[model samples]
Target: MTKENMEEGVNQKNVESTQMKEEKKIDEEDTKEAEKVNLTKVTTFEELLEVVGTRGKWNVLTFLMCILVAFTSPLQTLSYQFLGATPDHWCQVTPLLEANWTHQQILDLAIPFSNSTGRPENCYMRDYDYTAAAALGYQTTMKDPSAVLRNSSSLIQCSVREFNLSQYISTVVTEWDLVCERRVLYSTTQAVMQGGKLFGFVLFAYLVDALGRRPVVLVCSAISIIAGFLAAASPNIEFYIVLKFIIAAVDAGQYLGIFVFVMETCASKYRAGAGTLIVIPWAVGYMVVPGIAYVIRPWKLLQVAYTVPALYTIIYFWLLPESPRWLIDQGRYQEAFKVISWVAKVNRKPLPADQVVLAAMENIYHQKAQGKEADSATKTFTSRLLNLLKQLLSLLLISELRVRTIIVFFCWFSASMVYYGIALNATNLSTDPYLYIFLGGLLEVPSYLLLWPALIYIGRKKSLVALYLFCGLCIFSVMGLMLTYPGEAEVAKVFFSQIGKMAVTAAFQLAWMYTAELFPTKFRSLAVGQASFCARIGSTSSPYINDLLGPYTVWAPSALFGSVSLVSAALAVLLPETRHCDLPESNDFFTKTKEAGAEGREQGVVDQDEGVLNPSFVSEAGETGSQIHPRKSDTH
Candidate 1:
């Protein structure tokens, strides 16, 4: 062959060879991609099945913890009831003072005249007029029959007549004043509960994030047991309030700890439902309170009745397991493995040991990488206080975080107002407080049941809005009944109020679920705490509002709560629908936020720069067993 022809022929061969090599490389890449997709599909299916199968164990533990945590709700209601009963004793003393006995004479007779030595000289005279004191008012020394006959003073006479007691050794000193003392005790008890709730939220939220949920819950249970016993056996009102406060504090810890534990352990799809279900036990506890109050009769015994739940904490020591999700968060792989293994074993399934190891490694690596990125992006704290403030600001500024906090606050405030308002006014509504309370609580069951389906199908916003609107309508209806036929239809008015109670109870249950869905995993505990804190503010304020307005004043709080519910409903419109949305990983969240904002700005609806949505500001659902679409543009 000629030299030129040989050169051309060789070049042609080389070109063909290169083309063949490129095709082979492309085929290999395609094969690898296919394998990766298949692997992901298999893993996703396995996760779904595993999560579904584990539901039984999750249900058991959740139910148990809920029962433990629920004691506080009823305790709060009972404390209110006990406080109301204080006037009973003072009411009993009125008639004794009206029975021709001088205030000095009544005081001389009522005060113990002899000391332990049985000597009159050793006795100290009591300063207050025991016989003349009204149920809950200032005392007057005047014995003018008409002055004594004033309706307020008549409370004492009414109590004396009811007890059928005499001037000397009268019910005024023993029963009437004792009731007043009991009132003071119960009031103190409530104050302790309030303090406990405040401290519990702050302490347990920090502890749940720092030490993990299981330990806090266990410790809280122990404290609850001890404090409960102390409260039950308290010899005097002073001791009762002190011990009750301690119990309440511990109980508060138990409350938040259980919530954190349950939500962390459950699959994301089941998280909202599980969170709402926890409130079932709380409703049950409320229903149980009136029955227990009837059985116990006295405030001290009622305290004991409430305290008995603390004994259940012993079961937790043996049965409860540390949350696998929390362990993973803390970078404790071995511990997470053990817990997951136990879960698998309990469910009669075997998890491949290596799969567990691989999953743990992947999670840790991903977390570390994300942490490095976040560290590079965010500012360093100059001091611990600044760091805390930074963290707080981060928590508050995040749209998902702030929205949930605000919504929960409104829900809680509204729920507390309506729940307590209905409960406190139960007597005004009907003679059967037990029946009324029981029905009110029983109605909440459907609410929880409805949440699972509503959340699964309709989404968070629709369900929450429906509940809020329903509650508002119920409140308005109750107000109408109270106003339109004030004294004519007592039966109908009471029944309508009960109906309102049921509606609000259901709304409250749904609110718990909605709040859980609105926070990211990292700040879940804090978000829940802040929401709870707002709720407590509502709970704390409800009593004062109720007292200031009276039973008929239910309309005031109902209207206030209704307005809040409407605002929440409007805010719900602003949030992205979270139903079936997989929890976003930390990285995916910010990327999507930027994409959404960019798209929004391109539409020219507003200044794109001003309205940019920060993905970091939105709480992302993380690794939930749901398909999430990539952000289309900045506009979303």
Candidate 2:
């Protein structure tokens, strides 16, 4: 080797070393700048909340006010069972009625027995009437009308319909003639309302996030009130559909605005209890709705009766305050300060200095900006879809997150399916629909009563498994007793179905918090929200499951529902115990982020470069359940 050639190689190596040093220096500067912006945000809202106090006088007052107004959602929603209820109807038989045949006599001579139901056919009946027999004075209160009408009469379609208005003065079914083959329209009303709710939850949330919670809530409340009134005055089915759709759609605001406000205002420590308390009013409203309908009788009057209470919320416009976090985000720092200061003053706590409030707000703003930057990278519809798909794939493909995602999804799907399915089956549960509904509401109290302690002591996993298994067992009992014992066990079947409702209702409520806990903060909201699509599918098909499958067998819907609950419980075994574990640090913890520093390390969460939970992160999980194995080091 020549000295010159060896020297040239040495020079090449020295130059490469220098370039590496310079690049390292530049990277350090960028890292430092990011730290300054992010680490400085350690003064979070929770810290500021400590000084202002969480469960102070102001918080309690706000909680009570919110609770009072909580009636709007349940009343408007649950009352539909009776208002849109289909009544008992049959052929009109005007000829016999005009000819002085009794209503029962006309029904006996005109309507034919159904081979399937073994009761008189609602849609089809004997073509012949008892007009001639009535005129001849052969059949009376003392004589049977069936003896007068020939048994060989051919069946024909009734041009007109008659309804038994003894139970209800009028319902949508009677008014619209939605009996027989046209009954699908009755189910459609419910579907359309549910569809509206589905659409509204998504749309209203976006608007609330963008427009401030108070205004969106006010608008929703006002619209809901107006829509409720207009529903009573609806001239036709089309008008009723549109109005009810609006009512259902706007109800999302009631959920998001009022409930969310109450949640945000209360101390984080009391969240589980607060949620349980809020539901107490809702259950009460549901219980009372049947009584109102029973007394009002007329569907239109029932509509007004159900709607009158929400009118009290007209006071919310003056009383409701904007969320301090939202105020901080909007850069309305002074307003935020004033609101918190007022809270502090009312609670008799020391007021926060403006600097402390501003500093906290600044930290929050920077943190939110970091989140925005992550989200802004994918702005278009296609990009968003691709991102969601990628996140979903990560959840399924990744080893640690996969089981939790699958289990959570099934929990959501089955809970919604069975919960709503049971609620909607009230009318069919007994001869008295009111009793089924009242008992449903009644049982909810105990179920929700059991929820807080069960979650606190039993843990999320065990509580869910026990509740679901018990529920499935009850449903299976209902199916077996109905198929086996039939009439003698009628009361027993209703009892079991009602108990099943209780278990699923608790499970349904528990899923909301459990799903959030299973995921990390990065994608927690997305994970929680996406699961609703499955829930939506479950809820939407529940009515149809009961309606479509009933003729073939009474147990078909319960069979499907019970099996789903059991399967969901079984899937839960694979989920890791999150009771003592922290939420996942990042959506895709496998993809380590160069920017993650003390914050990520502190939470024991691996940093990722995404917005939503790779699974989804729950900021604060209310209660916890069992997990198979938990380690002190596990972040999520």
Candidate 3:
């Protein structure tokens, strides 16, 4: 009886064991299949990022961090407008002031009225004996000593500078006496800052590539903060200029590093609006500066306030995530995996198989290695120059491409020149420079929002022309008001300036997109890079035009900007509209002047460029999704 029961129990146990083995076998097969699918899915880290979930919490956090880094960048660029501004200064007559003679009396006793404007001369003073004038109670022997000097026969340049610090407690202009003849130093400093920005972008690009973006940006930001503090305490203009150049350069790296990090980490889908998103945060940063400066009053304290914000970026060391792409490139696969897995988890998505991820990373490592080998093989500098020259030739030599390239380059230049011109003169537009600057920043946001709609309904070339036309007209109005009502119409001038600012800003966004659409894939990056170079030239020259022409006339900058904008508008009309047209692949495509047909316009194009410009449904997905997030605006 015991033997029969024991044999039955053993049979049941064997059946249970077989079922468990089958389940395990099935699980193993499913994992292997998943691994096989995932292993070949992506060869690069960027592709791997998309597979792991791209536009998620990780990406959002990264973008916000980048924005924080960008928030105070405008300070380095625009601060000089305020910090180097010449206040209501006059020739110093200290003895007259000590003798109970009022400012009006001293102004009259020593300063003469300008013949042209009937206003007191700020840079010129009469060779009057202040002791004798005060001894005489600065009376009519000086002929309206309370109003104007008696004679302009013996005029001299200001010997002792006295700044009226009612607006700013201190500035480079006031502290260093950079007024009148020395005023060009203000423009010189601004130009140097622009150069520093250019150099910083180039330097940081290399640094981030070598040391990784997270650390490089953070370290540079710290250095930038220190430099800013040192600048606040700068003993002289020479020292201040050196520190400012350093701040501008370091700030560029601060922005460039985080920007590159975000771009690498962001999905392709978000990269388009990356332009708009990227700029607004910087604008916000710029918008706040006026308020901060207004409250701080003193230039040194305002600098401290501006410099302290950069310290907020120090939290980046703890909160800022490193680019997974960078880590894998550095062969830090394990750390990259951990970051990727965290991203997937936060995004509520499953990750690719571990082995597959490791394999993809290894493949990317080899690809990077091959790239470095290629660079080394080419020997770096010489190859880059030759490639650059070849690109230049391709742009200039081709028939239709050459004219289009030139027109687009002008568009870039005019847009940048007008943009920086209006921006730099924000303070001069109104007595309340803070409000002028704040409103300028506020108004720019709508221009970006309206850009896509403008491109959609108004057509590209026409929209660009309209923006330039509007900007030019507004700037001209500003010039007229300044000339016609120099004493009044501050509000009107500020309002027109804001309108011009918005239009130029829209034109800037349009120019960026228009240039990309104008060129083919072959020359797109090179064209954009060259355009950026041209834009830098325009921006670099703007400060000089603003400050140098200031002594000649207050409206001189406006006149120049308005003229260039109008000319640019006219030039824009000559450019063939790119709206709904295929991106030409070669110079020959431009030579074929025939417009795209109705169906191509309605449904998108193909035969226009032939092979690459596909109108297929699959191609539509990539193009359409990205279109929703176009590069509407980008910060300089």
lDDT of 2 by residue, 396-435 (tens): 7666566667778778889988887888785445546788
Supply every candidate's count of residue pairs whose N, Cα or C atoms clash at under 3 angstroms: 23, 21, 0
lDDT of each: 0.55, 0.68, 0.70
TM-score per candidate, chains pooled: 0.71, 0.78, 0.74
| 229 Cα displacement, candidate 1 (Å) | 1.9
The TM-score obtained by model 2 is 0.78
lDDT of 1 by residue, 67-139 (tens): 5567455654444454234221123234445565554444433333333324321113233444444432333
The alpha-carbon lDDT assigned to residue 444 of candidate 2 equals: 90
Compare candidates 1 and 3 on TM-score and give the better one. 3
Off by over 4 Å in 1: 1-53, 56-79, 82-195, 235-239, 354-361, 364-382, 427-431, 551-555, 584-591, 594-636
Using TM-score as the measure, the top candidate is 2
Which ten-residue region of model 3 has the weakest summed lDDT? 608-617
